[model samples]
Target chain A: MLSPAYLAVAAALLLALGPALPAFAGRPIIAGKPAPSEAAATARWLTAQNTWGFLSTISSDLSGAPFGNVVSYSDGVPGESHGIPYFYLTTLDPTARDALEDQRTSFTLSEFPLGTCGKIDPENPTCAKLTLTGKLKLVDLQSSEADLAKSALFTKHPEMKDWPKNHHFQILKLEIENIFLIDWFGGPKPISPTEYLEYGKNQALLKLS
Target chain B: MLSPAYLAVAAALLLALGPALPAFAGRPIIAGKPAPSEAAATARWLTAQNTWGFLSTISSDLSGAPFGNVVSYSDGVPGESHGIPYFYLTTLDPTARDALEDQRTSFTLSEFPLGTCGKIDPENPTCAKLTLTGKLKLVDLQSSEADLAKSALFTKHPEMKDWPKNHHFQILKLEIENIFLIDWFGGPKPISPTEYLEYGKNQALLKLS
Candidate 1:
């Protein structure tokens, strides 16, 4: 093993090289990815960590084909997740239009982009994947829930606030009814929506006990 | 600007710091991401570079709700792309089973994970997104197309070949009907399936001319 002084010198050298390399060169450390065994924790962790996922809806334009669109979403403000994904979407996009026509939808996220799945095939069970299926509902702008949703969305995606006003962006949330999480071998874990939503609360109670 | 000697020392330091850092520490340089103006090229590039994407299908298990699943897919062997995505799926998974019941499907990919988007938000049109609406069909194992697909899938995903034979993995191809590409602001670019598939050929002809 190298001495502490040697390691310090190496780290200093890396900082010196940082400006000349790519943006990811500094290699900022990411933390808080839950263990695979913590099924509810892992599922909620994925929602909080990822900024974007694929939202699928029944497409009216394609004569009932299932359409999946690349979209940005937020579970809540960073470090204070509530488990329900919220989106700022416009009907000018097909996904929002489809959701209005038919609310049945699913949102999918993968652990591959989180940089924690090191060298594993994305399809590998150990890499982790989540699919939440439910009805997509529009939030009433006047309601307190909408205020919370806007804060959750804007905090994660500052650019959304500056998007074209004429686009008629609306707030939408997934009324999650089914949760499918696969973080290890054997198959997808059986996780109810309530279990997923109340994971943090349950963990707090366990600590207090 | 720094002198050559100083830059060389910094590079040496980065190499030294590599092993102690995370998997993304080395920050492998990615290239060939086309500009937003090259809409067709950008769409094809997203398909060729990504190994997996979200495949959406109408779910029979969930009362016909649209379901999106994380899946591994390959368009072709590296550096020899055919622009038609092929998937290695097992009926044990709901995606394949749903495709059998209803062929209407769409596959979605985003350029955000390619690390070429820089600081741009994923929802920003400039970051690039592609959706291919199509029919999901299984390839007959006896056909020559299956040989090409297997070679393509194996070249990009070697672990796929080692998956258990008892899982009954089968090859499926998307029969693309429509293409939606968003690489710039304004709105989705209208790209026909024919235009997308023939882009490489058209590019070669233009180069020769």
Candidate 2:
């Protein structure tokens, strides 16, 4: 014989935690961050938690110097994370422009901005940093994959939807070829693209989240 | 007569606001951030406030692909920013190793992490983003400049001082040649390195802060 208030609270909790519900434009519910020992889990967790990252590309404007720019990104819309980060970029900016000229790029994310580092210095290995290196490829706006990627990105970054159309903001993603993750002291963890992209598919990570 | 409690409060406020005091490793007392219209002032302000950034360098190990790494940095002791970023890095990391091979590098900082952007998106031009492109040079430990840089770093990141001795962490600084600042709409503001470094020196920015 539970009180009505308690019953209502339980119902809300169930809806929030239920995985079957179609999660939309909101942050995903990560039950708790995975242990540092779980490299793939940690990498996926970092990507899921952060909304923006520093993107590096070979500069066409600066005689091949490495250029880093801060930009917003999303891996998925809430509970349905695909682990492939999608970005809304405009060619007016050098990041998108550089990618057009030379696709070689790296997207770096840090745990510090997530406020989970807990006073640990960002450079500390334990603080966790993930750099996904590969090619930055543009997504065809007419494709269904583009529709999914745009949904994933816009849900995480709602303002992107209202950006001026003249800027020709396009969808782009990192085709991760090499993963460089430093979550602990020994050195960078070697995580293959398959291990990272297919992380949650086996259901091993669902429980942790 | 003023109460002792009130007097103590006043004295503490004065000490915090005093520009003459030698600020050590702690968050700077920026009375307030400069207006976005002030390009040099805004660039210096962003640099002074952030303690860490994403560093991009040409990867010698990854076939000259651009690599970005999260690293802690300091421009000066709290309130006294010199507009040049200093880093404590070990060659064990690809960033430092890459810097040795190719001096070209870019250090990027975002105002979003400072929590001043409010409900605005991180990619919003009003939120501010800065990139300093130049050569990453290792500092001579014996040089007096290293002593100052280390003090600036250790105070902001005290954990760096106790880092394992075997790692051989060395001090490095970015010799800035180009400045890219986006604090408002319409695109990046042009700011010369000299104007950025001399921002506070002329005392034009002190009043704003």
DockQ of all models, two decimals each: 0.29, 0.32
DockQ of 1: 0.29
Model 1 over residues A72-98: C-alpha lDDT tens digits?
999887767888999999998999999
Which TM-score does chain B of candidate 2 obtain?
Answer: 0.83
Quality of model 1 by C-alpha lDDT: 0.81
Proportion of native contacts present in model 2: 0.75
Candidate 2 error regions (>4 Å): A1-31, A204-209, B1-31, B204-209
Off by over 4 Å in 1: A1-32, A202-209, B1-31, B202-209
lDDT of 2 by residue, B1-209 (tens): 44445544654664586544322111222236665557888899888888999999999999999999999999888767888999999999999999999999999999988887766788877688999999999999999999999999999998788776777899999999999999766799999999888777856443322
- Candidate 1 predicts chain B with a TM-score of 0.81
- Pairs of residues at least 3 apart in sequence or in different chains that clash in candidate 1: none
Using lDDT, give the best candidate's number: 2
> Would you list the C-alpha lDDT of every candidate in the order shown?
0.81, 0.83
